[model samples]
Target chain A: MSYITGPDVVKYACSCGLLKPISHLYFCRYCFQLRCSFCVCHEVDSNFCGKCSENIPSSEARVKKNRCGNCYVCPSCQQELSTRIASKGPVNPEDSKSTPKKMYYLSCQFCRWSSRDVGIPDQSTVTGGWPERENVHSNRLQELVDMYKAIVLAQKQQKDKDKKKQRGKFLSYTDRTGVTAAALRKRIGLPAEFTHPILKNKPKEPEPASAKTEVDEVPEQLLTEPINLMEITTVEQRLLQPEAQPVTVDKLFPVHKQLSIKRSLRCRHCEHNVSKPEYNPSSVKFKIQLFAYYHIPEIRIVTVEPLRAGKQCELIVKFTNPTQHQTTIAFLKLNMDEEDASLDSEVAEVIQDLDQTLSLQEKQQMSLTSLPLSTSQPSSLISVPSRQPSLTIEPRKISQEVNCDIEVPTSSFILPPRDDAAEYDDSGDTHNIQDDPKLVKWRKSNKAFIKLNVTPMSDLALNSEVVCGFIMQHIYTNTVASKEPQKYNHKVKVFLRLGQLVGSE
Target chain B: MSRNNIKILPGALVCEESKLRGDITIGSGTIVHPSATIIAEAGPIIIGECCLIEEQVKIIHRLPFDQQNKENTTPVLIIGSHNVFEVDCTVESPKIGNNNVFESKCYVGNKVTVSNGCIIGAGCRVTEEQILKENIIIFGSKCQMREGLDRPGLQTLQMETLSKMIPNYHHIKKPNKKV
Candidate 1:
């Protein structure tokens, strides 16, 4: 349970400069940059019912107002309602020919709310055929909509006519020939001017509605009787049906379950998918998942000594390499400006060129997915797909304050690649590598516990939390963009909250 | 510690591996699984018919610190009919009503009184001193309570299957009294 609700002690700084745990950040392989939800573009991949896991086509979803047709939720509790069969007794118990049809009703398991509570009759078929309520003012609302449309069309027509009249900088043939059209019309005995025929088909305005003098007053029966508050619906219950906002419980109706969508996250800078789920709704696997945890070394605090202001404290943290290739980790000053200028430009340019040729195979696989849309929709009504301009968010400054200083280790450590079989084997360590005994506390397969000396600033107040940060630079191997893997140093800032400062020793 | 004074009614299935202490009565048709601990430390515990006490469930009747010195009163823990104490759940409630389900890994403290049709959901810990209203369903990690319209369905089929399956695998403690 602490995996989800626990306090995040270890955080990695994203390329966008927000501090988040490794799982929440996405790794964009194309740009080799960390992207969080704030920096990524989320697009709906498919629409599906969460309860039934049935994928609904985008066009069908639009027609149904983005609601699942077969699934429903309880009006009282807003939980998925299951269809339960009610087997009624046969009309004639002894008669051989008599049979009873099974009736089905929607019921919520959590609150045990049945459709019969709201007077909805059971259906003979399993699929829902629940009665729908029609809005009383729909016709009047449609007429008002048409009136507004006609008014806007008439205004547009007048503006077009005015624009045509303004465009006569040069004279016409009739004027250049020393005879104006009006004077020539009298000579030829023609009509004064032919009005633009297209302008005659003008939109007509509807009659304006007048307000009624009388308003709805409270009924006489309400004043005489005490209201039972239990029988009335609460504000949350009423708001569930915004169209009706039923005040009484008896008027409650089963609501169609809203359709859920699976979204794919794309890096806004490069327009490449960072995380994409499989097309099947039931499949829990992802087609493209570039999580930072898969590519970067994970760090967790193991133990720390008592913290005092102006004193050096020993802090131990465990580092684990998750990738299949061995990587060397080095500690550097937590300054991003110096590192950004000296690193990554040449390697990034090399990768970007290789990505063009390497992405040809994946581009075809991604382009073949076309959701079949029914052709009955008119060509004009179907919205044409237009290219959306890619958006890039400016990187923000890191917000965490480091109140403690860390002594950067001069020597770097090498972490072996992850081995699945080593977890089950009971054999002792076989790999021989020289290590700095003062820095390395312990070592195992793909994991090591390292020690560091941290000193809290002298001016910090007693009982104030002390946080320390450092830069962890690791060699990242990129094998996807080329046949031969190219290695580049990837630097990430890490922060650790080293408890609170106590009294001075 | 007091001696074991267990009275198993006819047709009650009590496995030999279960740990039952002090004065206790197992009602007819009740199935006590192996390793279920029923420690009646304060007073007698009377369990009703068709109760399913599964493996690793601890039904303890522990008296409070002040009540241990008093001689006049010994609070009896009474569990009602058709109640299900699922696996690894600890129930020390003073009173439990009929058709209640204590789901797996939940802890019901001694001060809480579980009323009829109450469901203490899986992994929930209810330690407060309050009487749960009828048909109250407490679920989720936060123990959010809602009033269910009706009681949860009984585990009749599960009990029937267990009755037929358990006797073949474990030794049964036969009922001393006849129906």
Candidate 2:
């Protein structure tokens, strides 16, 4: 649990070369590689109002400028404003039998800011139609937008005509003849040109705004009067109403709460979704979550002896196999300077070529594999041809320097597959696999305690932090696309902080 | 550090489930939720009228290290009227003023003096020695301070509803004072 907010004492180098906790990395089953956020394609899966939890369509969200219409945040505190109802007494005492009328206004529980403070009228109904501001220069801006659209259209058409002229090696029958297309159109009682009438003439340009040379003089009252800091608005308060940027606090208005989006991450190499959340705004579950924690063997630092410069220390680490299939864990010498991950790029290229042919087969296999995935994805979330394919981020050299050398043991260890029933069954582990007594200090059901010898560099300064690292090669069982399980070697570089080196006693 | 000497004024609803130690005074119309602790280790604690202390809230009045062995000059920690101490907050402030709010899970150290209409926001820890000005709001994890134009609105509605609902379910300590 401390890994969420604690120091990064243990880090795994992501395929993209970024050092991240194992929980933050995602495992791509198809590519058999770890993908971090940097190496994944992020797409907005859905937009929803955080307050009301109402899903908004992309078109509606665009039109509404991605803000919830009903939910308002306090301009002062930036907290969600709740609508409160106040009851009014009956106007006539004789008719006291009538129920009181209810009026609603927005209020902030944190800052005590209310809509009434800004002179906004209370509404009788709960869903009050809050007043919205229109930009004073919107009409002029609209004219400019339309004019640019027309200009772009004319430019595009001109380019198309030039392209046609260049490619027209063999003249058309009409062009070769004594008649042109325009002349034929006129002869057929149609318009001489099919171009837009606006395009026929140059696009109208809006009147340019002129600046005044003279500026308004500051009021004399400001120089003479003592200022009240309480009356003036702070930078944060003014920024909330960016359109107005009112200096006075009374002019601040409640702003609509911005919409939040759920994002789905896709693996760049395989072009497959690595993580996708469920469509419901309230549900925290994901439809496809390929977090590396579920597949990789987790390592936690159990204990380590006080490190002295050039002195050997015993370091203990606990490893747990999270997968359903047993895996063989091997330690490889850590290489900080170069990476063999570039070889994966060539492999990815081959997969990319296969993906092109796989799509055609996928269309055929769509009905057969309907139960698992890709059948329930929303149209908005589908990968479109217009969007460019995500490029894989280049792996970087592991940045942390290893000050301590870890002795790599020659023997590999076997981790039993995780069993859900083993914890409650109370029955001892029945596995017959033999473990190296010197390497493996303890073994339980699915977890093993491994001991390693580490030594801090002799040249390291006194009290300097000592870092040690090694590459872990594990057997990954791939069961996604085959009737029988296919296994492969997956290498992951892990670094550990083994506390600081002390001077020799 | 002393025997319990609780004095509840008339109209004050002090739940019997709450823990009160040493000398303490609960003013009229004050509501103390069950499980709230008011410890007066150094001296007596005088909570004013209409104050609301919610569950898991701890109001401790222990003396500072330097003052622990010294003769106490002002032995009473006076909390003002209409103040609200929300859930799970720990307040050891020597001085607290009227209309102030100590939000949920916040910690007000002994050195801090909370003035009138001030608010210590949720989860904020203010251990540094400083006097909070009127209407000052200390918020966020960094304990950033911002001045507000007005104090937070009273929790009268919530307090009114609680005063009616609490006595029906839990045992009530009888008011020992008329006012």
Candidate 3:
């Protein structure tokens, strides 16, 4: 139960050499590998306001600057402000027929701040039409953005012309007939040149922005007057209103609540979604969720005797087969050097082909030189395919240390598949199986506890924690059925933080 | 609206619909609105003058678990003058000083000692055993504490208006003796 919220004492080494708990790892069925958040690609799925739970389309969210249209947060405390009604008594107290008029205003119940306190008038409607402040420099910024876009487009056109010149293969009659036509027109006594219709209608280039020399001077009162910390806005408060960034508290306006986004994870190697959430923000269901906890066998420390330096202690660990098929657990010596040597041998075979594809010169010849694009036409008119992100994650060697030694058992144990009905049935020992009493201590329907001898390192400081690790090799049966239903050995390095060592014997 | 085991001093305006139970004493000039409940489970309670207890406000006097084993003595909850308990607030504080304001929907646990001019903001659950400093205001979702430059002003106008309007709508619990 503590494993859910407490610190992760047991960790599994990911394929990318990062150590993480089982909950943080996702199983990619196509690649048959465990992928962590660092190895997977994240994409925004939807944007919605958490306060009102209203789904805002991505395009509308962009137009609203990723903020909710109707919701607002308090400028002082950032809490959601609720609309409250204030009843104003009748205008004429002497008139018996006059009725009270109600008005609405935004108020932060937590901070006791009312819109009236800030001199904002109450509206006649419940959802008050709050005045929104616009960016003062919006026009200037828009001009700058337009200028940059034009400059970029012009530079792109220039590059296109250069590329066309490099090709120089298009033999248009205009170039060859210019001199011949002039001589022919001279022989006939007529004008040789006629303006092309397309060139006359070309768009005019946009003017560039000019740098300004004058700037605003600092106010002289800032030097003499003592600053009031309460009245002055902090950096965080100013940043909340990115457009205005008011320095005084009086200028602080209610900010629209920022929208939250749901993210979907995709495996980089297979381009398959490892986890994808539903489109609706209110629903917490997932469309695709391939968690490693469901695919791999889970190991837990059941109990361990008091650990003393240089003394062997009995450590009992339970293994549960989460899959529908039975699995055999084998304990191997935690030898990373041997694994690295095997990986090097495999890499030696593929390095030649990898080197050929990794060369920049070869890539350039294959991409640009052979396939020449028609430069006479507008490049924007041609819709080129978007570039796909290539998988570039390289596997790294495991970097970890083990201070305690675990006595490897000679025999391996088998765990039965998990059965939901087994929980209710009182009848036990339905399946007759032979087990080694030395290695297997206790057995349940889907779980089994195995005993091992562990010894902490001697000559160590007192009260130091004992850490140990092992290479767990389990027989995995692939149920994907893409190929033959075959059994394979899947190995993962498991590290555990054992209890602290007592005084040396 | 239990009349037994309750005392309302002269000039105290307590609505007839207000629920009063156990040993409780209302001071002079204090106003307790309808639906306000005052329950003294551990011992008697003594409220000072000019305090305003709003609708649905609950004032409970219950001893803490740690203090239950002490020598058997009747503990007293003393609330100072001019304190305001806003709507739907529950205050179990054993000691409260003058000019303290417990905002709407806020909860003060049995271990908190609220001093003068302290404002417990709305929806704040201050269960941690500690003493609140004078002129301190706790607000926000994070329960941030800020020192106010001055004490909050008394709701004199609202109290006066309520005093004038409430007598016309409901019955008032009269003081048993004249001062």
**Best lDDT goes to which candidate?**
2
Task: Output the worst ten-in-a-row residue range by lDDT, candidate 2 chain A.
Answer: A367-376
For each candidate, what is chain B's TM-score?
0.97, 0.97, 0.95
- State the TM-score of candidate 1 restricted to chain B: 0.97
User: What's the lDDT for residue A206 in model 1?
Assistant: 54
* DockQ of every candidate: 0.21, 0.24, 0.24
Candidate 3, residues B15-94, lDDT tens digits: the string is: 99999888888999899999999998888899999999999999999879999788678889999999999999999998
In CAPRI terms, where does candidate 3 land?
A: acceptable
Candidates in order: C-alpha RMSD to true structure: 8.9, 8.5, 12.3
Tens-place lDDT digits, model 1, residues B1-179? 49899999998999999999999999999999999999999999999999999999999998656567988877788999999999999999989999999999999998899999998888989998899988887866667666666787899999999999999999999898766
Q: Which candidate is the best by TM-score?
A: 2
Model 3: how far residue A98 lies from native, Å: 7.9
Q: Distance from true position, residue A220, model 3, in Å?
A: 11
Model 2 has a DockQ score of: 0.24
Residue B100 lDDT (model 1): 96
**What ranking emerges by lDDT with the best candidate at the front?**
2, 1, 3
A297-332 per-residue lDDT for model 3 (tens digits):
887887988888888899998888888888888888
- Please tell me which model should have the higher lDDT, number 1 or number 2: 2
